[model samples]
Target: MLIAHLSDLHIRPQGMLYQGLVDSNTMCEQAIAHLNKLLPRPDVVIITGDLVDEGLPQEYAMARELLAGIEQPLLMIPGNHDDRTLMGSTFSQPYLSSTAGPWHFVADDLGPVRIIGVDVTVPLEHHGDMTEAAGAWLDAALAQEPTRPTLVMLHQPPFLSGIPYIDTYACRNSERLREVVQRYPAIERVVCGHIHRSMQLRFGGTVLCTAPSTTTAIGLALDAEAEEASYVEPPALLLHHWKVDTGLITHWVPIGTFRGPLPFA
Candidate 1:
């Protein structure tokens, strides 16, 4: 099964720019188009939060319209930039529990993978937290289906990325989450998106990967005192391909038309 992983769309209201500079809406549309044109379309598309630039009704409306272009089953969670209530009301699917409280759910029927999406975003705040209750929920969920090749997804990565500025908003109390995940070896990956860049790290006996944004990438500055910034880097998405014997393999696919398919004879 092929699963497309997209994150940080940061969609703005129609005719508006993201952060008053980048045309994120257009880029999001292009990303959707790129997904539609894939030869063997993905079985599912999981977007790991930051669905809009702000938690506004207009933004949600625009996001709904743009995301309607996807041809495959889609799953999503709330990010710091998103209002859970608005997102839930705007997009209704079987995966969302409700428009109130955290949006957590498990989708076990989407092909060969079991997807468990948890909401770790703290309302009206940029940072994330893994509360004891949330950790317990995850533990129980994973225990329910211990042998399945699962994918655990949350908006914020549970570990620091070494980029000091962004790490300020890293998930707190992550050890609670980590301890539970460590017990579940069947988890193929712990996927996330919020930092606007593609990153990977070893975590909890599995790999944790953060997908790049469909719009701008957060500037990579490892200096301790570096300021926060963003760049109009080449947009991209991740494709997680799963096979019975191979488990899961992820590929970074850049968006937009590029001259290629040249024979190397």
Candidate 2:
């Protein structure tokens, strides 16, 4: 099925601009409008996380309104910036229960490739962590559908991407996560956000894909002496499609006003 994978919206209030440069809210609204206008709309939309710049109640309200334009099922997990209780309240979907610490949800059926969302958000922290229980839940979910094609969605990546700044705050206990994933051959992909740049890597014989930020991108500096943030890159999102038999395919769709029907034959 076609799935629109978006992450790092960081949607702020209407008048508040992000980093004094981009209007984060408007950018996200534009993305939603664009998605609505796509010819064959995605069957589902999985939001990796950092739905808001900070997990404010008002932010969640604004986020809910901004995301209402999505015409299909919308699934979300928490990021380091998200507050689990508040997000869970605003999310309000029956599947987003707090019993799992972070919302760990699974599809009841395997007809369209099962999807499970793992929450790695840690309150008042800039890093992510997966509890032992969370790892066990992941194991159980995979066990439930050993032969079905499955995709795992989380906010923080389980593997390092060479960006030292982000790597410092990446998902803690990655070894545990890797161990769980290696045991599950049914997992076709692992999707994450937070790096703010589109990246791909091989982990546990599965593809780990990170979408670009809806607000701005984190520059990819594999090694640098200075530790700071830069805004040289533009905003973007990801479109992923998968089927039980076909595996996964992803596209990096940039977010902005583009006029493209250029001839490229």
lDDT of each: 0.93, 0.82
- Candidate 1's clash total is 0
lDDT of 1 by residue, 115-196 (tens): 9999999999999999988999899999998999999999998898989989989889999988998999999999999999
Q: List, residue by residue over 45-147, the lDDT tens digit for candidate 2.
A: 8899899887778888989899988878888888888777777777765575564466889864534778898877777888888789989988988898788
Q: Total clashing residue pairs per candidate?
A: 0, 0
Tell me the deviation in Å of residue 23 in model 1.
0.4
Find the candidate with the highest lDDT and give its number: 1
TM-score of each candidate structure, all chains considered together: 0.98, 0.93
Q: Pick the candidate with the highest TM-score.
A: 1
* Model 2 residue 178 lDDT score: 89
Error of 2 at 83 (Å): 1.5
Off by over 4 Å in 2: 109-111, 243-245
